[model samples]
Target: MWRDPGAPADSFYEIRPECTDVPKSRFRIKAGKTLSARKWHAAFSPEGYLDIGKTLSRIHRGGIHPSIRGEVWEFLLGCYDPKSTFEERDEIRQRRRTQYAEWKEECRQLFPLVGSGRFITAPVVTEDGQPIQDPLVLLENNPDGGAIVPPQTPQDNNGMGPPSTDAANKLEKMTDKGVIQWMLTLHQIGLDVIRTDRTLVFYEKKENLSKLWDILAVYARIDTDVGYCQGMSDLCSPMIILLNDEADAFWCFERLMRRLRGNFRCTDSSVGVEAQLSNLASITQVIDPKLHQHLEHLGGGDYLFAFRMLMVLFRREFSFCDSLYLWEMMWALEYDPDMFWLYEDAEETSDKSEEAKARLKSIRHYGKYERENMKNASKSSEEPPLPISVFLVASVLKEKSATLLQQARGLDDVVKILNDVNGNLDAKKACVAALKLHKKYLKKAKKP
Candidate 1:
């Protein structure tokens, strides 16, 4: 009734030359160096307080080194507060790992295959807790995780036979909505997992692939509000690879999702990235009216062509390594020091004195570009401004303005032009140009 976790995976990911050729990211390093490990350690007090303000500043100008990216990301993503001491963080880490193990056990109770070091590409059960007997869906363990092929064990007739006594009892016992939703999403997760970053050597190990599936599955179990979406694997994959510890990677992905969940929330009338696209249209109209008018004339005013870039954070447009580099650069530049407390939703800040509280709100933590926006941004707090990512999309648009305006006679041409930048876009220069374009757009937008 279940695939053996120790069974031969029958799947493998081969490294391609394109995957290894990482582009150099020297982010106009005239101001300061990339946040090296030494600087990272020095920022921490002897008692274990982290100087996040200084840390964010250096990271903004220059990105963090890969050796320490996952650890640094925990702070930036608000997994752990910079104010927490070494012992406190250690305790928190242990508690989180314990919590994650409990979650996996809970899921395993319902579906014994969850932590089995293998994932399903097809549904195993229905909403009513009955087994799905569709033999055609019994897919093979394809090397690339591609869709629909011959079964691995054709002699077994591609049938996932009736649930065994233990499995039947487990499914019949769980009648809760959360468990039901979790069961429904498992097959979808399997399908996406196979397609997610299959070209990387990191995914060659079947256990590594199962590790990612486990993280996503557990995440789905906890974050019931936004239970597993298609593009999430792309976001979660980097965390698993970056943070070797599965629990740490899960928490990191959770924290990262806190900032990005809005992009995944969709409604009847609009997709999640709609707000960013609206902002992009406004930005283009203000900063480059000529190009905006041309786009509108071409019926490309909605700016949906750039949706994939904003949706996956340009994971598709840039090389894998460059994508990570670009994420740190963008996150560093857009950092807000008060973000930690805001993200934590902590009430303890009220207990601190004015001086102590002021440190948390320090503008020094903001990047040069972010500091400018904070100074000149509208005072109305009702409507928060668009994220820096929208501005980054605008920057990409402006970079390709000439080609788009001239050659983009139709929407397809625009898509082709942007897609052509795949693996060629410079991560550093993209950050530099985004900040510059953001400043220019703000000035132009303020005009009467």
Candidate 2:
């Protein structure tokens, strides 16, 4: 497991005053306006070829306006192909909604609270799939099959009326293991959902909180491999708030987890973030040897302190609005034209990976930062699969490199140096620094 070093998991971060500042009437404002609804409409040709290059550039430089962010995120997250025509995308969207509906219906059948605009704060089933008949839980039936899971043994059955034969048989068909695993995660999802974005007015509505729970519960049921993790609520809440439609938000969150779920995968011995931590170690060692050595001497070489930032994409470090802005910018800058294809056939191996690397040199729709990185990618000794976010985190580290080297006498100090950065970092500046550091690192990696 990745060691969570400091602060309770539920703690909130403060936002900088600049996040709420009046819009600066400057070039950036005009540049950002280029991504307005009108510009977005114009970006598509008559046949609906999205000018992804232009759109990506605009988002990277100026970030996205709130009104169009969710839509733009659909493309950025690879939910829809930019190459697809308008009609094709519309068809895909409808099909995905139907598909999501099916997934939700499946979960609703297993658990009554799904799509009920209410969520449970306690587990409704025990580890062995026996229903927890708590008055607080109030387990009910799915109209089609009725999901009151039959108690495994009579001793466990507390005078409950027998389930209808049809409901019992339907549940019997499901694997005992799958049912237990899904059932166990219900309350964890609920607990996280209520606490997620609570300080924001958007989540003050109980229905809104339940909506997030519904999306997450459905996700955990469908994605049994990763299941429900605490930080996932942080990732899902923004999607719920940004995209008004629950299914769309679910799909968007699914796409994000496609990229991020690896971080949550853990074993008794190790953590998934270790891979990125290794990459971050490499970047820091190469970029600033002195700072890296100082950290190593402080027993901070593992970079465990950065676990939260990578886990939740710096959600706690930046203000909610600024974090959203940072996400679009990072996604735009890291945008890959081949992401849709690659993600779909992710299990395919070596040959496809090589082909993708080769295509990077000539692809026209890649975002600004990725496009430039491709030119130098060959020169770099190694290219980590997910480089931008790690580099962005590295940029944040470099932002505090001096303080870290001077006063970070131990591991805790290193974490404190980072904690001080919470909410004060600038999204635009951090992104710019990451890109600069990326180019420099690429050049530095090429040797005689």
Q: What is the Å distance of residue 171 in model 2 from its true position?
A: 9.9
| Per-model TM against the reference | 0.85, 0.81
**Residue-wise lDDT of candidate 1 within 1-448, one digit each (tens)?**
3434232211121354565554332233222467877889999998898998889778865677666789998887778767778998898899889989999998887788778776666666677656555533455545443554333344322222223445444545346767777887887887677667766778766788788888999888888778888899999998987798999999899888888888887777877778888888999999888989998998988988988888889888775666777888787777776666676544644664556546666677676666876777664244775677788788888888899888998988988998888877887788888888887877776678
Model 2 bad stretches (over 4 Å): 1-34, 135-175, 344-362, 377-384
Per-residue lDDT tens digits for candidate 2, residues 1-448, read 3323232211122322433532221112343343667788889899987888888877776766555778999999998767668898888788889999999998888876678766655555667776655433344432232334222224222112233333333443334798789878877776576557655656656678778888898888888888888899999988987898898999999999988988988889987888999889889988988988998999888889999999999888876777788888889888887787766544532434555445433466787677777776666536444558898988988889999988988898898889998867777888899889887777686653
**Candidate 1, residue 317: how far the Cα is off, in Å:** 1.1
How close to the true structure is residue 70 of candidate 2, measured as C-alpha lDDT? Answer: 88
Q: Compared to the true structure, candidate 1 yields what TM-score?
A: 0.85
**Under the 3 Å rule for N, CA and C atoms, how many clashes does model 2 have?**
0
Q: After superposition, how far is residue 347 of candidate 1 from its true place, in Å?
A: 7.1
Against the true structure, candidate 2 reaches a TM-score of 0.81
